[model samples]
Target chain A: MSGAKPKLTTSAMIASLAAEGHRTSGAPFGHALVALAQTRLDIVGMTADLAKYTDLHVFAAAYPDRFYQMGMAEQLLMGAAAGMAREGLVPFVTTYAVFAARRAYDFVCLAIAEEKLDVKICCALPGLTSGYGPSHQATEDIAIFRGMPNLVIVDPCDAFDIAQAVPAIAAYKGPVYMRLLRGQVPLLLDEYDYRFELGRAKLLRDGADVLVISSGLMTMRALEAAKRLEADRVGVAVLHTPTIKPLDEATILEHAAKPGRIVVVAENHSVNGGLGEAVAALLLRNRIAPPFHQIGLPDAFLAAGALPTLHDRYGISTTAVAERIKSWL
Target chain B: MADPSTVSRRSNVSLAQRAWRIRRNALRMAAVQGQGYIGQALGVADVLAVSYFHALRYRPEEPLWEGRDRFLLSVGHYAIALYAALIEAGIIPESELETYGTDDSRLPMSGMASYTPGMEISGGSLGQGLAIAVGVCLGLRRKNVNAFVVNLLSDGELDEGATWEAAMSAAHWRLDRLIALVDVNNQQADGPSSRVLGFEPLVAKWESFGWHAQRVDGNSIPALVAAFDAARALTEPRPRVILCDTRMACGVDFLERREKTHFLRVEPDEWDAALAALGEMPA
Candidate 1:
């Protein structure tokens, strides 16, 4: 089924790249960055040796002169980005989500966030996207970063969202932490004809019985759940909020304000402080009381497993979300 | 704002006075609070004084100037030193120094970038500042605009694995614009670093990581200035590390001799005696 747009799927984007035998996430970010480079000369890229994992090698390929390989140093990656911002040039820093969140948090906090530099800290494999287990999974990335001042967090839903969000974040003035959906991520938002906005939420579908407030690729699963719920004659609206930090409270409160509305926050992250908690806080603080069902991984560290198995095990799949909403109703 | 050429040659008098004041004010500030990191403040006073007063270019009126040299105080307990320097540098009013460690003061126990002006990075969590400093360096480099990135750390911070990771990365990228100053006061919170985690031959360790490393008598003004001057002269891609062998509480006699390294507590009577014994601030 065509999501916001039917022409492209996340897998199809990756499959096209993979079909040509390109192996790492670094290739795509780098390639797309170079494509962005032709039009934008002010664009520069830096990596903490996750260039291969984050696919920034594509940009590295096009602008070898502008690309800096900082080598396994996430702190320097952020510092360099800040330095570039100081010089009136835009810098796109790439790394694994875990390293950006856990390893180089202080640098990101000080050099970028505190200073309010226009640095793009784009990270790949956010949440359970990585099979490398708890160490690599950035389950607590949003939680740790949400409290940081002047940082805009973006958890794009699919390839189309990523493609749209990249230029969107580039145009943004302050620092940004974009949770990357790499490796031919699914294209769901385009199917709904949704447009990207930094702090706005996109209501993919309308429903009356329950509202699925989701972000990132899980919004796709929410769409699938909504379709399934439609067959059961239960209305499930999908509110896709790509920008998680400056959370679109207006959209959240509007949908959740209705009585008997079941708000299910689905995400590929841990339940603690992820989309589930963010949405709940927004509703509760705004006095928009609704029965909330937080569908996400538990508080504990998730173990290493296959992608399909991990999603099913974590209860973030379409079937699992549908079942949880059915039970909540 | 003056051109880069004129800015460097502007004046050393104010900066020199700033060094003296940073030392004097730091001691006085520590005396007011009854006890604080006087040793660190006194040790790195010259370098901090130089950076704030002369060597670095910044706008006091515009703290967020795009072309300003960045300073990250990795050893946050040394806020007294920074407060003294910032005041002398005109980043804040000298009157603010009265509220040094007080409740209402913008100055907190540790350095916070959010509250303080001219504080490039908020530091206190130990080894994290170097990493943050690296971020500033990368940011500046990406813009192709050459700006100095200086990080001041304690000798004890060498024990943190994160410091090494930042050092390795900085050296790998050949961040010549970046400079790291190790306040080798030989003391940690527990005691002298030798007793805690001995980083003996620390210069060699930095050299092994591909950095241009040097040692300086941190208390000597000429030596500190010369060391920094030489560091700025290097053209290689490697970052520079300056090992400052500073005496804990260099200007004060009593606190320098105390076994306590973290926080020093002097009796009311001894406080006056200590201040008097320290005498006039060095020129």
Candidate 2:
């Protein structure tokens, strides 16, 4: 949307995902957790050393006694959270999605998910949120966790979605793994007056030309792209699916089954085991094959660079999503 | 905090007799499946005996009592051992030992909390128990719930970096009510635990990690009672660990002399031999 922006710096690598001049909310997850902890006395917060980065420091500061800093050990973080949940306390744990998925996968699987504990694992930097390189990029987190049973996975669109999602995850009596949109997350869903359900997909906007099924920051980008596509006389629909696992198949089939619309699955994750593949498998199994296109990162380790340039290069930014849809049309 | 010595309803000899029963229960369960983690169960019997009879506080009829001290089995393979203790304490039915590790059985080869009452955490995946115990202790502290937490881990589990990480955090949090019983049987899946990864100066490692550490022969009922009492008596604002150096198949001479006894498939004839050995030990 920015036609004339200043020269982007390396700081852009870790800059807020919010577009310039867009409304943003700071630390929605941390603040929402603090709000939930007040009424739910059993609610406790925990994190590895990424509290400041994941914005859980807000909750930690507010509830000093209820917070547990488990150092930099992700395995221990997941295990301890599982343990806490066993003893009648609900633990909301935060860390980088990369560490939760890659580093402590077995711990989460055997300890939290298998036991069906009421532990909320909120991880930041899902997919390519960071520009620091492959190490910081959690491009395959969804793929890693999608196979784990008894885990409810969420990929909130922005700060407003996260704010609505925190309590929803806690209210549900089981283990959850949500992707956190930390510090200065974009607030787009609030414009639609959207209320997030634990496992529901919300169709924010509708059109006849194309239907964009998305989650995470890509949903925000898809909403932006829908507006940009309007100028080109293209009517685009944005279906925001925050809950990735146990997908809202009823709503998805209802929307995607609408006749004569090109179905596009966009995500801030790798092409492997993401929303694109998930939707594809769903549509295939249900015997409804629409003309499909996927806008996801390539199946490779992405290079380290400024997030803006990386987003455009990998075709996930608003400009890229719009351009790709227009060319397909 | 419940002072264990004050709450005891039995003497050391009674505790020893319970140990024999625990060992007998474990051997019976293993015989049901014709195989199990019998070596570890036999080795850690006395630790479990002291834990249920002395150090911990709980209602045998009510496994999920809110005031109950948690006994976490981090070495999930030792499910047979913990199940034996639970049965002795009247938490689980003694008759259920017949159905152990069988189809539609509450007892599985590995431990899971949902499968049985009094079984706190799902384990079998080593190196994760101490972390869960740390969390339980943290939760207890937050709720101002006066309950101690005990985590039983294997020496082989010490090789897991997560154990050390949780160990460090427990001490950092000054979880004075948390106690760890490490079954240092000197045996792991590969070989002797010390040679497997060298957790020697183990006491120093735990102390450096900010824990009050103690070592005892895990098989000796008197020594375990003393160690449990010491861990409970400590006023230090830090986590405590009782490193029980145990012999695999402690009371059974034939199995005890065997070099490799980690996961045993006891011959059909050895069940009688094992029960006979337990009968020989002084109660």
Worst ten in a row by lDDT for model 2 chain B: B3-12
Q: Model 2: which docking level applies? A: medium
Q: Tell me the tens digit of each residue's lDDT in model 2 across A156-184.
A: 99888999999999999999999988888
All candidates: TM-score: 0.85, 0.96
Predicted structure with the largest DockQ when compared to the true one: 2
| CAPRI class of candidate 1 | acceptable
Positional deviation of residue B34's Cα in model 1 after best superposition, in angstroms? 3.0
Clashing pairs in 2: B76-B124
Query: Residue A241 error for model 2, in Å?
Result: 0.7
- TM-score of each model's chain B: 0.91, 0.94
Per-residue lDDT tens digits for candidate 2, residues B1-283, read 8633345455445887888888999989988788888888988899998898877888876678788888998888899999999998888999899999889899988898889988898877889999889888888877789889999999989899999889888988899999998999888887777678988998998988999999998889899999999999999998999999988887777888776656765789888888887776454
Model 1 / residue A8 / CA error / Å: 26
